[model samples]
Target: MNNNTVDKSVLNTASVKPKVLLDDAPLSKFHIKIAGLTFGAHFTDGYILGIIGFALTILTPQMGLNALWTGLIGASALIGLFIGSLVLGWISDHIGRQKIFVFSFILITVASFLQFFADSAIELVLLRILLGIGLGGDYSVGHTMLAEIAPRKQRGVLLGSFSVIWTVGYVCANIIGIYFADSTNPDIWKWLLASSTIPAIIILLLRIGTPESPRWLESKGRIEEGQAIVSKHLGENIVLDRQEIASDAGFKLLFSRKYIKRTVFNCIFWVTLVIPYFAIYTFLPLILESFGMSSNHSTDFLLNIILLVGAFLGIYFTAKFSRRGFLIWSFVVLAAMLGMLALLPSTMTLLLVAVFGVFTLIMSAVSNLVGVFPAESFPTEIRSSGVGLATSVSRFGSAAGTFLLPLSIANLGIQSSMLILVAVLLVGLVVSVLWAPETKNLTLNRASKD
Candidate 1:
């Protein structure tokens, strides 16, 4: 019962039996409900994050902002996301996921609506940072909750589907952005910024009465409560053994030899993938314009639709292939696409857009693993913290990319900037092949030990 030493026998049995029980459990309405509710938070987070790109397009001229101010404003939320994921993720490990889950939505909803009242750049930056915190919490808490509740057989599909929902929200934001982009009305940016509140409020209502994660409860030694909840969802005859209870290690466990590999893998891979993604998408309008294509709202909208389709395909493939295989292939393809873009002539405008669309498609597929791998790779006790730390660190890369992308485009030129991203993707591919674990069908407890 020592807090520092896990009962290995329990973990060994847990590695096998619970997976069988969960895999065989009949799919129920509760499973669908949990997936939907947890995914809702991700959906809202995507909207809040994606809408900013479009809002800034208009706000730049209105507020008379410069490049430094523009980058700072764009990176502000990403900075807050870093802090929020690290702090709240650690907090959730001790307090509980449900509390943080509900609180995050409330914070997001309030922060999003407050954007309507902001008249200055500073006010908008502060509010966006607050909104990012809530989104960050959702990244840690929401993904962990879904992984804990999902059937072992379906975890990849369910967790990978998180990105699909995110894509839906991102596409919706772009659609709204396209609709309002040309409005002469001064308040159009305000309306665009505030629109995220609608989804947050609705998702909050849906999640208000949701149950706590059963895996988390079991990890906390609340065996009866955990079993009861699991039985209600999976079936009443199911019985979890005592050995499956995890040792109650604090946040330091993340650095312990048992977990350090996973922690390192998640952090490195996530940063490598997210840097280019945030950099490219955040400046998509500008990137298109620089390529001599129309940077109009309609063009952005069409590209987002392509992204949505690609995301759906990614989710489907996640369910169909090994996690390691899918991810390794994704990195290779992404790197190849970027490399081609960097080397190809800029005068090939139509060819450039076509290649860009393919790049987005592969990127969407690769991104499905970001949330799933971290959530599944850690034990229930440190799942949030592990995920949080990885997310927080990766946000640093995202923030840097978002902040410097304009400068890179200006100084290095599009081709050279893209070459840099190609290098990043290649690094990710190497790390993934060297360290990433295959997590498809493993029980939560078993997957953690990998």
Candidate 2:
């Protein structure tokens, strides 16, 4: 309940590791488990969001809401997401990453099930707000955990793997939603929504045996606990330079003048990037409907498969090259693709539409940069906070995008909307080049210290 109790645990932890035990310690199974837990936690929420993309249009009519209202309800999730990111990120720093993980997972499980019971617009909005809270917390905790546990050399690639699971989750949701729609089972929609909880529950249960972040432990003056956690992954034989990595100055470290500029830049970057990405993604069904497509479910299924595959391949290339380099290249591709979208006619081209699928995946894949860079940009003390705040603020852009899409489509049509996307992507390109720092080779801890 108090710092004293926590301190007692840390003291005991620090005192127990025998110095002579240093030997060739193999990586613990718990280390691997953390990676899976991190991936699963982030993956589940992404899966749910992807499902909503498939369902947003279907449920709009069923729930007796119009297009604008449906978009607002979806936007509600972004609002809750913004609030949660700020709160939970600070909590991860103040409490611990493990605690946030537990709390968030429980909330997600509850919210996912709530989707099944919502019969009205108000109910859907409330449930979405709750879902957003859990989703926000997932990014904060999962990003921090992955950053902390990964080997320095493989950190970018390993953290990038989370993006891979994200694609998988999105694809799974799309596939499942389409499958249910194809079956004509009225109850299947609820089943699909509720199914998202399975991954969260499994991850939550697995997390029971997972350890806290070693960096966080050390920052809290729990050198022993931190060392033990580190030893679990690094082997007891490995000697760390500092036996005490704790600091009374954890909070100060993030807000110092040195890091304040980094914070401001990140805030701007996060808020803007999600606008175009989600504008296209969340309303893909509506966009397709404007093209005279009949079945929203089928379109979503195909889009998901295409985007998911593209995102994975993009991340693979990003890891293989560098985040900044890959992002620059991707923007060029996306810009060209968005331009091509302007040329797409309603009647003419199944093949052109198919080619458009590749662009959808490209955009989704490239957008991971929006998520990945924040964690790598700040110090351990503020890494979660930085990520959380960035994402939370960015949801404003997302909300705007969601709100604007209908209006944009109304006045400008799909081609104009696609042109607008091209413009937004162009901004992303410029900001990424001018403002966002290249974090391809940096770690939060190391970067913060520099």
Q: Compare the candidates by TM-score and give the number of the best one.
A: 1
TM-score for each predicted model, relative to the true structure: 0.92, 0.85
- Model 1 earns a TM-score of 0.92
* Clash count, one per candidate: 1, 3
Candidate 1 lDDT score relative to the true structure: 0.85
lDDT of 2 by residue, 193-263 (tens): 77887887887787775678877776667768877766666666544334334344544655688876567
lDDT of 1 at 365: 77
Give the poorly placed runs of model 2, Cα more than 4 Å off.
1-28, 182-187, 239-257, 268-271, 289-302, 343-351, 448-450
lDDT of 1 by residue, 1-450 (tens): 779999889887776633335444656788899889888887887787788887898999989999998998889889889988999988888888999989988988999899999999999989989988988888889888888777777788889988889988888888888777789998899999999999999988888977787777878888788788887766765555443666667678888988888889999999999999999998887887776777776677678877888888888888889899999998988898888778877788888788888999989877889878999898788999999999999998999999999999989898889889999989999999999988888777555465
* lDDT for position 25 in model 1: 61
